[model samples]
Target chain A: MLDAVILTGLTLGAIVLGLLFIMALLSPLEALTWWAGWTSHAPSPGKLSEEVREEIEAQADRRREVGARPRFYLVYLTAIGGVSAEELSYRERVFLETLTEALPEAVIISDVYPFSVTNNPLTGERMLGWLWRKIHEKRKTITGGILATFIFARNLFNVAVSADPRYGPINNAGVAREIAKSLYRHDYPLAGDIPVVIMGWSGGGQIAVGVAPFLCLGLDAPIYVVSIGGVLTDDPGIAFVEHLWHLQGDKDHFHLISDILFPGRWPFIKNSAWNRFKRAGKMTVITPGPMSHTGKGDYFDSNAILPNGQTFVERTVEIIRDAVRTIQPPPPTSIEEELEELLGRGA
Target chain B: MLNNSLRSLMAISPELQHALLVLFLAILSLLFGNSVVLFANRVSRSQFIRSLLAFAFLFLLTFLFWTLSVQALSAMVFGVHKPFVDVFIIVSQSFTPFILGFLILLPHLGHYLYALLRVWVVINLIIHVAHAYDFGSAQALVVSLLGWLLLELATSLSFLKLDAVKRWFLKIATGKAEYRDPNDLVMAYVRAQRALMLQAAQQQEGRDA
Candidate 1:
């Protein structure tokens, strides 16, 4: 009886291992199929929630009232654990709000889902949405943590797809289109000459860098990336980024994976995109004191305080605000100026 | 019976037809290319039918040689003597991953994928060799390494110019291997898409005017 029980357990374990092995082998098919147009049948922007539509409308109204054209646009790409385009975690929402307050000249666009080329979020518009939702619900449990690796692995493959020379171009083009559509919806003119900032957190940073060149070409704008504890690759898109301001806490060692896995990031590979950008004086690496990569003292943690009495989130906002100020467009005509001009005409 | 089967096979869908062609070309390039070169003098190319027969014979000869090499190494290194037919079947089956050899033609990523498949073949060989001979994993690994070393020594001794063989295989697998930088293609594609979008917008403006 004991022998039979042992045999059954071993068989089950083997089957699970085989399935995982097969999954790893087939991970490249996602980008391959998207490039070949075999999948990604979801609509371009998918379904926008009522709240998102209302927010877009409010943004346009505010711009008109202020008599100011947004000097620049800030697009925030969420982390890999993000489940949807319209949804933002509480801390992420707070960070964006802080940015909006600090840099009122910049309009924030955060609806483009970076994990997918078609902007299809994991929990909506995808055929396997329910499966991801199931995994996300139990992600804190032991078995759930194990299952969550599948989601992370799938997104990691996307990062590789963007880094892959043969597939990066096609996938980046698709992602650029998604961002362009989001920008257009937010009253960004196709012919607008404003600079665009792509702010990515965690794995979103790699996707941000991967899509920069194509996004710039598509929108005809100067592109910059603000990476916050991002695991970045030595992608060719770095060449096209006008400036890249990468912020990390000294305790944040997650990015070392890129250094270990990608030979291009090695110091010996001096001609790599990362090294080239560094040499060109267009790259800035900022270490913002002691903090973890994601957990209690991560970049977005509002309660994590520094010696300077500022929260971690506040410091991140301050750094990004300074970066945006460097690239800010000439001040637009303010509402007060327009009103004063009308009063002078009346007098 | 053969004539009837040929008629049915020719009636397959276009997608199936393309798949079959891709499979045949991949097999021809991966399985038969090196073997044909090795047996060039022995293969009679007087007629199409004769050449076809020679191709099958060369494939079998290459298979026999591979089986013998693995069997000899296993016996010498681990004192395991699996049956000749069993070893032959295992080695031949290990080539299954090469069915996707057409992917090796992909521009930049293809080169890496092909290397990965080669690694996969080695791993497949190690697992099957250990199972078939009932040897420990370490013993099987040593035997595999010995076989690989022997092949390398033969190549280094000028049995075949490795570079020339690689160039020939690459040429057969991917004609002209033109390195297309993804950045250049993406820039061009994005420019084209932007132009189209602007054209559509202008058309809408004209209609409104």
Candidate 2:
């Protein structure tokens, strides 16, 4: 009877412990509950309280006095072919949409048509009429499988080029020049000294590198250009970065592996992210911690964040909050230390 | 005589110098620990294991404390283990989807390279979690959380500050807000679409001409 009593006690204890352990694991997950907890806390004083939410509504009230809102636009280029516009991910769309949403006083510019001479029948007519048609016809003789493979290879090549600054900047010069002209017009109130952030994902990033030099040519403002997945290079760094922000997601395997398969100045941005943000006495290279090259972040449960469906509009609202944030990078390390830091044993 | 000879021997070998240098570094690490390890670019393997141990210990301690706290208390008591566990699970799970998705996409990768990447993601996730956890005092935590939200707001503002494209986005977003007659937005969007199509066609014709 004593032995039976001990076994029952042990079984009851085990059941209690397991339930406690599992509950412990699951509670932080009730994100809505945590959010409710946050709301219960008193509102923090000052600009933070004003800047994060309902204050954006009040921001429009001052817009008339703020006058012509300074404008910035990114002319994005997706891969030459392959992934449809609809196939692009939420974050990818967010990168573009958030900025466009921002200009209470400006416009966001983009072209959906593929800049290909073949395959994009709508936009292809002029260029395909002469060169691509004959070339494609001849190539078609080599079998559809070869054609399909070529298309895939070409699409991959655009993504690769987009990641590197060297070959990409020149891929679409006319578009870059036009986009630059529109954003740089002198009429905007924030003109002359306002900040403009231009970014591109994939092919758009490549053109950004090229666009930088043109921006340098026309403007003398304290402009900040941040390119997320694009490659920009060739012209001297001084010509481009009055201040530049580059955000690369370390988790994204596509860019990480592409660096090995085809490499470039990507290491400059990638390595900086790895090391402490450089600062010189009072000045710093890029901002640090929460403010970074990567856009505003999303938790895994970002889907469950708010009202109803996890649609593009809800995410876009979140994305807007992500993009406008900034922090001055930690003061950069001494130059000698930085060089030794980046270069290592060599020199 | 043995003591005198040992003193003389200690002065003779370069190998002894190398050994002493290594010993000094190890002692330094035990003293400064990870602050020294931070000198490395990514977390070193030793540092990684150490952080894991730190996390595991903190986790165990927090759980034990919470369990102890809740045990004798009424059923209304809450356990404190949830935050750390969620942190650990998030760190582990976030990487898997991307890596697994990529693996399915690129199956032939060598095991060693894949393992290296897996380790890299784990370390980064740890950094992210720790940054979130360490805000100073309760007063400080209150301030920093607000700062985090401000940073969020500022970023959103930066996007809103863009040019022509912003208008289009506002239209789309406001259109979805649906207080309006739904047909107005659709009609506007359709007209814009038509205008863009016509413009592209015209540009193509001009080029052909």
Candidate 3:
């Protein structure tokens, strides 16, 4: 009887793992088909919150009035639990609010959904989108919570798509285009040498790195990534980033998933992009202390207090704000310089 | 000399790196007895030299047809002209992922796995073509889709009706011909197992009685 029970358990385990493996392999299809024009129309560049849009425009106006080029364009990509670019959880809203208040001079964008290459949120209109909406709604109940984990599954698969060299370049280009559109919508001067800062929390870290190379190519701007307890792989995109600041809470063991999953992250794999960046002094890892990966004690949790008498959210904002401040935007372009650039392009 | 060669390999363009990786995978797949080799071996009735030669010929033909079809379609539709050698390498190397084609033999998930492998091959083809030709993602997609469509129409209208062609395609596609209809085989196996279980239960009951 015990042997039979063991056999049944093992069979069930194998079936579940097999199904998940297939799901992972199939995950990049939507992004691939979208790029191939086989899927229904590509999602338009996602909409920004009107309030944030006005704030960004106000900053643009201020920069113009000062006759100074715009500084950093800070884009935040939320963790896997995010429902939409605009629909931030209360904790996430507070976190963004802190960043906005701390960096009034910089344009803050939180509307780009990192999980989907097309920026189509899980709750948005697509095939099986209604099912995702239902699952999200029931996320609080036990069974609903299990169903809602499919959101994580989808995002995790997207992370794989970004990391998989086979699909990464094509899919990341789509995502990079969306981000460029977002920056342009906020009045980013395409001609200016303004830096773009990507702040990725949790799984968003991997995506931010994955899309960095394409983003850099499209905009011809320096790219900086700030990962807050993010799970990152040794993606080739790391080579394109100007610098990376990774903030892991002491208690956030989940960030080590990349170390466990990616063989390239192993010590013996001496020449991975991650290691190259580290060797070049282009990556920094900071432990923010005491906070966990998510929920009550996550980086964005205002209730989580540190030994330094600051909230986790406060500490996160400070670290990111300082990182952004350290990056000096290029000096304003003189008329002669601008004319030279145009002439060069024309030639 | 090895260090210099390694440095040279590292210094090459990403497109070449990708092609080289795909070639490595193809060679590895062949070593592990890929479907094409297995099919040829089966046809040759365990004659190793004959099977190897036939496999090499089929692979060469496939490589030539795929590259030319894609190149012709791209030029006609998109007015893009890439070097024949570049397209040939990209097209042939894209087939490396079919090494995983054997996974299709799994019961219950076999057909889905087969479909996934085809999708993988298609995506790989599009990606490498785009990189090799410097085509935008959309253009690459159009080229790949049109190329496949043209090949499908040509092959179907030309050779698909032949019984030998059908048998050969089936053998190459499914890795092994013995389990051509895997689902039916699985169902039959299940039925046999159920009969044995019933027989054992009846005999136990008889002894108890």
Candidate 1 local lDDT, B1-209, one digit each (tens): 99998898799655445544543554565543222122111222233234444444445554556678889988776677877756766675566677666555342355576788789978887887888788788987876656667666765776567546644543444342122354554465555555545444444445546
Candidate 2 local lDDT, B88-204, one digit each (tens): 343333233223322211111222344655465444434433444442244323322343344346446756653334334433433211122212322232233223322333343
DockQ, prediction 2: 0.01
If ranked by DockQ, best first, what sequence of candidates would result? 1, 3, 2
Writing each residue's lDDT as its tens digit, candidate 2 over A169-260 gives 32222233334334423232211234444545444444454444434332223334444443333223224444445444333333344445
Computed on C-alphas against the true complex, the DockQ of each candidate is 0.11, 0.01, 0.02
Best-performing candidate as measured by TM-score:
1
What are the runs in model 1 whose C-alpha is more than 4 Å off? A1-17, A40-66, A140-143, A328-347, B2-113, B116-186, B204-209
- Ranked by TM-score from best down, the candidates are 1, 3, 2
* Candidate 2 iRMSD in angstroms: 24.0
Q: What are the lDDT figures for the candidates, one per model?
A: 0.69, 0.35, 0.70
Ordering by lDDT: 3, 1, 2
Q: Would you estimate the TM-scores of all the predictions?
A: 0.65, 0.31, 0.59
lDDT of 3 by residue, B1-209 (tens): 99999999999767777766765555444533333223212233343344444455555555567778788878888788877767867886787786675444332234455677778889998998888778899988887777667666766775456446645754565343332232232223223322332233334335546
Per-model fnat list: 0.21, 0.00, 0.00
Cα lDDT tens digits, model 3, A81-189, are 8878978789989999999999988889888888776778889987878988998889889989877667887777777777765456656766775686688667676
